[model samples]
Target chain A: MKDWRYWLAEQRGTLLAFGIFIVMFVIYTSNHPAGFTANVVQTAANKGVLLAFVAMAQTLVVITAGIDLSVGMIFLLTNCLASWLVVGTPMQTTLGVIAVLAVGLLCGAINGAIVIYGRLQPIVATIATGAVYYGIGLLLRPFPGGSVNEDLADAMTGRVFDVVPASLVVLLAIVLVIWVPFSRSVLGRAAYAAGSSETAAYMSGVPIRRGKFAAYTLAGLLAAIGGLFLTFFTYTGDAAYASGNAYTLFSIAAVVLGGVSLFGGKGSAIGAIFGALAFRTIGDLLFVFDFDPLWQPLFQGVILLVAVSLGAFALFRVRNRLEWFL
Target chain B: MSETTPMVGKSNGGIAGRMPKFIRRADPAVLTAFACIVLLLFLGSLYSRSFLSPEYLLQQLKVASFLGVIATGMMLVVLLGQIDLSVPWSVAAGAMMACAAAAYGPAGVVLAIPFGIFCGVLIGIVNGIGVAYLRIPSMIITLATNAVAQGLMVVYTGGFSPQDSATGAMRYLATGFAIPGVPNAVIIWALIGAAMVFVLTRTGFGRTVYGIGNRERAAYLSGIDTRRVVMIAFAVSGGLSAFGGVLLAGYASKAAQSMGDAYLLPSIAAVVLGGTSILGGRGSYLGTVAGVILITLLQSILSVMQMPEAGRQIIYGVVIVAMLLLYGRAPASR
Candidate 1:
C-alpha cells in the first residue's frame, strides 16, 4: 500500500467513528424541536465536552495499551475537591484549581507507579486506585452540597460572545495544547510503540516507562479538567457513585466509538472526542424521537454494541485462529 | 539440536533447583490469602469483641457466600484470560426474573430458581457468542451486555422498584439455617464451590480451561476445542452471577435496581486476591475462598467501625492493589 493508503487504513476506525457521530448528531439536531439553534448546540456541547475530556484522558492510557478504570473516579474526586476549593476569591479559586489538578496528577501518578514500577496489571491497579479516589471524593462531598466560584463556572460553561459554546472552545484548546503536543512528541511515539508491542519498543530503546507514565499522568489531568467542567455545569459537588461509574463506562464506549482501539497502539484523542459527542447524541437522539426515557440504557447499549462490532470486522479476515486470541 | 536440547533441560533444572523446595510445592497465593484472613480476624478482634463471636463470623460467612458464588464463575472467565463485566446486571436480571416468576404461582415458585438461572444462562450465551464468535473483547462485550440487561430490567420494572418479592423457597435458601446455625446460603455456596473444584481439577474440561488460559493456540493445536471452552466459561460465569443475584434477592426479600452493581469490582478483586492470575490460568478455589472470606470479614469490620461507604471503597481498592503487588508482579508461568 502507498503511504497515504496506509495512513487511511490506519485512520479507518477513527474516520468511521467520526462518521457515525456526525450522522447521529445531524439526525438528532434535525429532529429536535428547536432545530440546530445555539441553545441546542450549547447544551449538547456542554454535555459532550465533559465526556470528551474524559474520553481524551482514556485515549491517552489506552494508546499505551493499558486502561485506566479510575478516570471516572478521578473526575469525581476532582469535582468534589473543586467544590470546596474553587469557591473563594480569585486567588483562592486559582490555587484551588491548581490543587485540584495537582490531586488528579497525583492520582494518575499513583496509578502509573502501581502499574509500572509495581508491575501490576493496569486494570486491577486502576480499579483499586479508582476506589481510593472515589472514597476520597465521597468523604469530600458526603452530603453533595458545595459551592463553586459562580462567576467563573458560568463564564466557562456559558457561551463565548453568544455564539460558540465556551466549553467547546475549551475542549478545542485542550486538544491543541495538550493532545496535539503530546501526540507529536517523542514520549507520545513511545507510548504508541509500547502499546503496539512493548517488547519491540523496549528493544528499540523507546522510553516506554516514561511514555506510559506520562500518558497516565496526562490522563489524570484531562479527567480533572472534565471534573472542573462538571463542577461548572452542575454548580455543586456530588459524589454520586452511579454517575462516576457511568462516566467510566461511557468514556470506554466513546473511546471505542471514536476508533481508538481498546487493544491499544492505535487511534486518536480527536476521534474519541467525536465518539464522546456521538455517544451523547445517541441519548439526545432518543429524547428528540420521543422514545420512552426508560428505553435509553437499552438503546444506548445496543448502539454501542453495534458500533463496537463494526471494529470486529477485521477479526473475520484473520486466517489463523490463534490471532483471535490477540 | 541435541546440544541445545540438553542445554535447555539443564537450564530448566537449574532454575527449578534455585527455588526453595516449599515455594515449588505450594501456591503462594493460597497461603497469602490465609494469612490475610487471619490478620483480618485478629484486627476485627482488636476492633471489637463481638466481631470474633461465632454468630458474627457466621454472618460474614453467609455474606461471603453471595460473593463466593459470583466469584466462582468470575474465576472461570478470569482463568480463561477473559472477563465478564456483565456480572452486575446478570445478577440483577437473575434476581428480578426469579422474583417476577415467583409471583405467578406454585409452579412459578418451583421454577423460579431455574427460571432465574436460565436468564443468566441466556445472557451468558450472548456474552459467549460475542467473545468467542464475534471476536470482540470480553471486557467490552460483557460491559455492553451488562448495560443491555440493566436497560431491559429497568424497562421491565417501569423505572420503579420491582414489585415482586422473593419466593418462600428463596428466602429460606438465603436467610434460613438448614443445619441449625448454618445458613443455607453457605451450604449452597459450598455445594457450588465443590462442583467448581471438581470441574476445575478432576475433569478434562478443567484441564482444557487451564490449557486455554495458559496459551489458547497451544491448547487448540493440542486439539482442545478452545472456543467451546471459552463459551462454556462465560456461560458459567453468567449463570453463576445470576445465581448470586437470586440469593441476594432472597436475602434482601426483594430485588432492587442496581443491586448487583456493588459486586462487579469485589468479585474481580476476590478472584485476583485469591492469587488467581488476572491474565488467566493457574489458580485454586481454596485461594479464592480465602480471598472471599477475607474481603467479607474486612467489609464487616469496616461497617462495624461505621466507616462510610467511601472509606470502605478506598480500603477495598487499597487491599486489591496490595494483593496484586504481592502476587501479580511475577511473570506468568507458561
Candidate 2:
C-alpha cells in the first residue's frame, strides 16, 4: 500500500468516530430549541467530557489487550475523596488534588500487580478490585453531601473566555500532556505488540509486563482526572452504585464505538473521545426530538448495538473457518 | 525434530504419570470449595444456636436456589469459553415480561412462567447470533444486549416502578413444597442440576461445548457445528437466568425494577468458586451446587455478624481474589 493509504488505514477508526460525532452534534444542534448557542454547546461539552475522560482511560488498558472494569469505580472513589479533600484553602486544595491522583495511581498499580504478577485474568481480577474500590468510595461518602472548593470548581467547569468550555480545554491538554507522549514511547509500542500477539512479542523481546503496568497505571490517573472533573461539576460526592456501573459499561461502549478493537492492539484515545461525545449526544438528540426521557436508554443501547455490528462485517470476508478463532 | 519429540514425551510422563490416580482424578478446586462451605457453617453456628438447625439449613438452600438457577446458565456459557454479561437484564426482562403477561387476563396467567423463560431465550438467541454469526465478542455483545434489555424494560414500565405481581402457579413453584418438608425452589434447582449433569456427561452436545472451548479450530475441523453449540449454550444460559428471575419474583410475590442486579456477580462468582474454569471447558455440576451453598452461608454469616455494606463488599471481593489465586491459575506456557 502507498504511504498515504497506510496512514489512512491507521487513522480510519478515529476518522469514522469523528464523523459520527460531527453528524450527531449537527443534528442535535439543528433541532434544539436554543439553536446551538454558546451556553448550549458549553453544557453539552461539560457532559461529554466526563465520559470522554473515562473512555480515554479505558482506551489505554484496552490497547494492551486487557480490560479494566475498575475505571468507573476509581472515578467514583477519587470523586468522593476529592469532595472531602479538594476544599478549604488554596494550598490545602492543591495537596488534596495530588493525594487523590496518587490514590488513583495506587489503585491502578494494585490492579497491575495482581494481573501481571499474581497471574489472574484481567476481567476477573479487575472485577474484584472494582468492588474494593467502590467499597472505599462508599465508606468515604455514605451519603451524597460533601463540598468542593467553589472557586476552583467554577473555573474548571465554566467556559474559557466566554467561548470554549474550560473542561474541553483541560481534556485537550490531558491528551497532549499524557496520551501523545505515552503513545510515542517505547512502552506503548511494547504494549501494542503484546496485545497483538503475546508470544510473538515475548520472542521479539518486548517488555510486556512493564508496558502493561504503565498502561494500567496511566489509566488510573486518567480516571482520577475524570473523577476530579465530576467533583467540579457536581460539588458533592455520591457513591451511587448504579451510576458507577453505568459509567463502566458506557466507557466500554464508547471505546468500541470509537473503533478500538475489544480484542485489543488497535485504535486511539482521540477516537474514543469522539465516540464518547457522540454517545452523550444520543441523550441530547432525544431531547431535541421531544421524546420522553425514558427513550434515552433504549436509544443509546440501539446505537451501540448498531455501531458494534458495523465492526462485525469484516467476518464475512474470511474464507477459512479457523481464522474466526484468530 | 526427532530428538525434541522424545524429550517432550519424557517430560510429560516424568511429571504427570508419577502422580497417584486419586490425586490426578480429583478436582482440587471443588474440594476446596466444599471445605470452605463447612468452615462457614461452623463459623455461623457460633453466631446463633439456630444456625445449624435443619430449618436454617433448608432456608439457606432455598435462598441459594435462585443463584443456583442463574449459575447453571453461566456455567454453560463459560464452558464454551464465552461469557454472557447480559444476565442481569435478561433476568429482569424475563421477570417483568412474565409479570406483564399475567396482567393480560386468564390465558396470560397460565403462560406467565413459560413466557418469562421464552423472553430470556430470545435474548440469548440475539446474543448467540452476534457471537456466532456476526463474530462479535461475547463480552461486548452481551453487554449491549443487557443495555438494550434494560432500556426496553424502562420504556415498558415508563420509568416508573412495575406493578405486576407473580401468578399463583409461579408463587407455588418458588415457595410451596411438592414433596413434604423440601421447599419447591430447592426441588426445582435439584431437577435443573440433575438435567445439567446428564446433559454435560451423556450428551453429544455437551461434548461439542467442551470441544469448542478447548479449541474452536479443532472442533470446527472435526465437523462439529461449533456455532450451533455456542448459540445453544447462550440460549440456555439466558433461559436459566430468566427462570431464576421468575423464581425470585415469585418468592417476593411481585416483580421489581433491577431485581436481577444482585444475582449477576454472585452467579458468576458461584460458578467460578465451583471449580468451573472461567476460561471454560472443565467443571462439574456438583461443584456449582457446593459453590451456591457456600456463598449463601457466607452471606448469612456476614449479615449475622452485622458487617456494614462496605465491609461486606470488600470481603466479598477479597474472598473471590483469594480463591482465584488458590486454583484458578492457568498452567504456565510459553
Candidate 3:
C-alpha cells in the first residue's frame, strides 16, 4: 500500500468519528430554532466537553486493552472535592485544583497497582475502587450542594472572541499537551503492544506493566479534569449515584463509537472526543424534533444500540469462526 | 502465589496429614468467606444481644435470598467467561412489567411472574445475539441493553413512579411460608440453588458452559455450539435477574423506578466472593451460597452498627478487593 493509504487505514477510526460528529452537529444545528448561532454552539460545546474528557480517560485504558469502571466516580469525587476546595483567592484555587488532580492520580495509581500487582481483573478491581471513590464523594457531598468560584467557572465556560468556545480551546490544548506527548512516547507504544497481544508484547520485553500503569494513572488525571469542568458547568458538586454510573457507561459507549476496540490495542482519544460530541448530540437531536422528554433515554439507547451494532458488521465477513474470539 | 502452590500441594499429600482432608481439599476462599460470616455474626452480637437470634438471622437469610437468586444467574454468565451488565435494568424491567401485568386483573395476576421473566429473557436474547452472533463484547452490549431497558421502562411508566402493586400470589411466593419455620423466599432460593447444582454437575449443557468459558475456540473445535451455550447462559441470567426483581417488588409490595439498581454489583460481588473465578470456567453453587450469606450478614451487621452509607460502601469495596486479592487473582499471563 502507498504511504498515504497506510496512513488512511491508521486514521480510519478517528476520521470516521470526526465525520459522525460533524454530520450530527449539522443535523442538530440546522434543525434548531437558533440556526447554528454562536450561543447554541457554545451551549453544545460545554455539554459535549464533559463526556469528551471522560471518554478520553476511557480511551487511555482501552488502548491498553483494559477498562476503568471508576472514571466516573473519580470524576464525581474530584468534583465534590473541588466544590469544597476550589474557592477563595486565585492562589488557593490553583492549589485546590492541584490537590484534586493529585487525588485523581492517586486513585488511578491504586487501580493500576491492584490490576497489575494484585493480578485482579480490571473490570472487578475498578468496580470496587469506584465504589470507594463514590463513597468518599458521598461523604463529601451527601446532599448534592457545594460551590465553585463563579469567576473561574464563567471564564472557562465562556467563548473566546465571541466565536470559539474556551472549553474547546482547552480541550485542544489538552490534546496537544497530554495526549500528543503520551501517544508518541515509548510508554504509549508499549501500552498499544500490550493491548494488541500481551504475550507477544511480553516476549518482546515491552514495558507492559509500566505502560499500563501510566495509561491508568493518566486516565485518572483526565477524569479529574472532567470532574473539574463538571463543577464549573453545574456550579456545585452533587454525588448522584445514577449520574456517575451513567457517565461511566456513556464513556464506554463513546469510546466504542469512536472506533476504539473494546477488545483493546486500537484507536485514539481524538476519535473518542468526537464520539462523545456525537453522542451528546443525540439528546439534542430529539429536542429539536420535538420529542417528549421521556423519550430521550429510549432514543439515546436505540441510537447507541445502532451505533454499536455498526461496529459488529465486520464479523459477517470473517470466514473462520475461531477468529471471532479474537 | 507460586510459592504457596507447592505448600498447599504438599499439605494435601500424605506426608503432611495434620489438616483435615476435607479442609485441605475444599476451596479456601469459600471456607474463608464462611469464616468471615461467623466472625461478622460474632461481631454483631457484641453490638446487640438480638443479633444472633434465630428470628433476626432468618430475616437476614430471607433478604439474602433475593441476592442469592440474582447471583445464581450471574454465576452462569461469569462461568461462560462473559458478564451481564444489564442485570440492574433486567431486574427493574421484570418487576415493573410484572406489576404492570398484575394491573390487568385476575388472568394478569396469574401471568405476571412468567411475563416478567419472559421480558427479561427477551432482553437476554438480544444480549446473547450481540455477544454470540454479532461478536460484540458482553460488557459493551449488556451496557447498551441496560440503557435500552432503562429507557423502555421510563417510557412505559411515563417518568412517573409505577402505580401497580404486587399481586397476592407474588407476595405469597416472596414472603409467605410454605413450611413452618421457613420463609417462602428461602424455600424458593433453596429450590433454585438445588436446580443450579444439579444442572451444573449433571448436565451436558453445563459442561459445555465451563468448556467454552475456559476456551471458546477449543470448545468450538470440539464440536460444541459455543454460541448457543453463550446465548442460553445470558438468557438464563436475564430471567433469573428478573425473577429476583419480582421477589423484590413482592417484598416492597410494589415496583419502583431504579429498584434494581442496588442488586447489580452486590450480586456480582456475592458470586465472586463465593470463590468463583471472575474470568469464567470454574466455580461451585455451594460457594455462591456461602458468599450470599456472608454478604447479607455483613450488611446486617454494618447496619446494626449504624455504619453510614459511605462507610458501608467503602467497606464493601475494600472487602471485595481484599477477597479478590485472596483468591480471585487470574493466572499470571501478563
Q: How many backbone clashes does candidate 3 have?
A: 0
Which candidate's TM-score is highest? Answer: 3
lDDT of each: 0.88, 0.88, 0.90
Residue A264 displacement (Å), model 1: 1.5
User: Proportion of native contacts found in each model?
Assistant: 0.67, 0.57, 0.69
Candidate 3 C-alpha lDDT tens digits along B1-334: 1223456667557644676666666676778888988899888889899988899989999999999999999999999888899999999999999999987778988999999999999999999999998988788789889999999998989965555698888899899988999999999999999999989988999889888878989999888888898999999999999999999999999988889988887988999999888988888888899999998998888887889998888999999999999889988874
Best by lDDT: 3
Candidate 1 per-residue lDDT, tens place, A98-179, comes to 9999998888888888888888878778878999999999999998889999999999988998999999999999999999
lDDT of 3 by residue, A1-326 (tens): 89999989998999999998999999999999999899999999999999999999999999998999999999999999999999989999999989999999999999999998899999889999999999999999988888988899999999999899999999999999999999999999999998999999999999999999999999999999999999999999999998999899889879988988776899999999999998999778989999889998888888788877776454865788678764
Q: DockQ winner among the candidates? A: 3
Cα deviation of B69, candidate 2, in Å: 0.6
Candidate 1 lDDT (Cα, whole model)? 0.88
What TM-score quantifies how close candidate 3 is to the native fold? 0.97
- Looking at candidate 1 chain B, the ten consecutive residues that score lowest on lDDT are B1-10
> TM-scores of the models, in the given order?
0.94, 0.95, 0.97
DockQ comparisons of all candidates to the true complex: 0.58, 0.62, 0.67
Regions of model 3 farther than 4 Å from truth: A312-319, B1-16, B159-162
For model 3, which pairs clash?
Answer: none
